[model samples]
Target: MNTLLLHCRPGFEGEVCAELSELAANLGVAGYAKGKAGGAHAEFVCSETGGAERLMQGARFNQLIFPRQWARGDYLALPETDRISVLLQALADYPQCGSLWLEVFDTNEGKELSNFCKKFEAPLRKALEKAGRLVEDPSKPRLLLTFKSGREVFLGIAETSNSALWPMGIPRLKFPREAPSRSTLKLEEAWHTFIPREQWDTRLSEDMTGVDLGAAPGGWTYQLVRRGMLVTAIDNGPMAQSLMDTGLVTHLMVDGFTWKPKQPVDWMVCDIVEKPARTAAMVEEWISGGHCREAVVNLKLPMKQRYAEVRKLLQRLDEAFKAERLRVSIACKQLYHDREEVTCHLRRL
Candidate 1:
């Protein structure tokens, strides 16, 4: 197969392509990306056979910023009748699969195919098991049957350990009614995406102290407060009375960009509306100056060439850290709750 299927947000299909193009060049995998602007997925068409698989093996999935999921597969068209026989024939030469995933694009059109995928999954699994193509081994490759339409599908394989944990790489999170704004989900998702669940109790414990910049209305502050951490909410605008009543928050009337904590803080978060590069630079000061040991911030992306812009910004920060001789871990993601911005997490070591 020569195509690597990549799932991304509907409006950001170009980013998926752009990100892979740069990444493939670094891995020495020759490929060009092509896809529709509003489509929920894109493909990196490798120039040679097996090159797609080589790219998959060479690039680390977690390091990828745009693609939610990746699978190397071949496009196939199945007959309306006896689909099972045709599918089985296509996979007859393939190795055993650890698990089967029935996926569709993350668009409205794709949601309409959900019932069909649900109905088709059971019989398909039975056929694979009967043919000895399905197994219980965790180390085996995963079978990805991505349905683009009723009879159109991409038959692909992905390494389970290297792929996203959730189907279609979309995590399901229910918004808490208590949060002051929907933006609260962004910070919550950041913690889950950037920090391992096993480390949550200690890293995000009640004993920690947090500061929320541009914390008007207290959306992000609610998350920190719920963790039982005492938070300093810095904003000139009014904050939510409910959060103020909690008594765990100190509402300071100040500018997030210019304000500095009196002493070092355990966690500092910013959801300020500003240029992406400027927000990143501010976070750098917080980390390098020892104002905060950990931070979660959002970078509002530009209208065009966002992938290229973020890469340059991150490269600039990397150079700065190297010069300062500091150890810090930084992760960024376009979260499900985010629109034109990306959430970032930075931790000092």
Candidate 2:
């Protein structure tokens, strides 16, 4: 069994570790060991050959900690250039390797580390270049360099890996590359953790209907329509012409709190830039009254307690639903595109 190291985004080590653990459990990865690197990175070792591939295939695997890896295969003394050359040769033979990155880790305290990094770069770069693939910028290359000590160094290369991440409750979602103008933004759809449409089952209700609070731009409404559901968009602002053209979107120019569907709908989706508590309260009321069968809401967070606030909100939702004698499934995730808030998804039991 090959040793696999999994790395995650900076500052999201804990969440990433949770993600990885979940992956391991679901994928049957064995011999796992996890830790952090000064709070900026999370690292875990697994013994599955396809572990890295599984991690990358999932949408959750955003950036590479070290995309590819090669074992040093030796320990004793050797010249820096010779060591790098030997590692580079192994990298060239590594079937999964693409472009290579260069960095030398100084685990040997007080050693001449910078010198090693500089000397190692030239030959490594040359070796990769001779193989017909040029090394791009060192700062953000597909390859990653890391070391535990003089006795061990890890070299990683970039390649595609597959993991059926969605079956494990991870949403498959991505962000838009360009921001839209105000008028166009209304038509834009923003789903935090949208499962692929094909994955939604009858148990989740395809006949679901939705109410989009602050729907002036109709971005959230589009998400409902795409699911083959009706949406009552509530806001005083103008909705994009495209949404109105869809006919599935209904524009209601009224205050969200004052506006309620004549009958309960399947869901309520909100994107109002308001206090988190207010948003939480609104959701609580709707669920308590049985106004909607499910909901997806956004909570705008303060600069601090961003993570803590979301945690508390979920706890409250659980308690609120319990008091009403209802069972609910809820998920909160900080989307790759989210800045100051998180998206919350809820389904009634």
Local distance difference test, each candidate:
0.90, 0.56
Runs of candidate 2 exceeding 4 Å displacement: 1-198, 201-207
Q: Residue 338 in candidate 2 has what lDDT?
A: 48
- Residues 1-349, candidate 2: write the lDDT tens digits: 1434443223445554555565667667664545464332344465665665554444334221111122211122334446755565655544434444433321233134546555666776676677754545433225544444444555554432221122111233443322122312222222323444454655234477788898766656665666677778899999877777767788878899767788999778888999998899898888778898777777887765454566677788889888878887776655433445666767776
The CA lDDT at 278 in model 1 is: 91
Q: Quick one: RMSD of model 1? A: 1.4
TM-score of each: 0.96, 0.54
lDDT tens digits, residues 69-154, model 1? 88998889988888899999988866789999999999998999989999999999999999999987789999988999989899
Best by lDDT: 1
* lDDT (Cα, 0-100) at 253 in candidate 2: 87
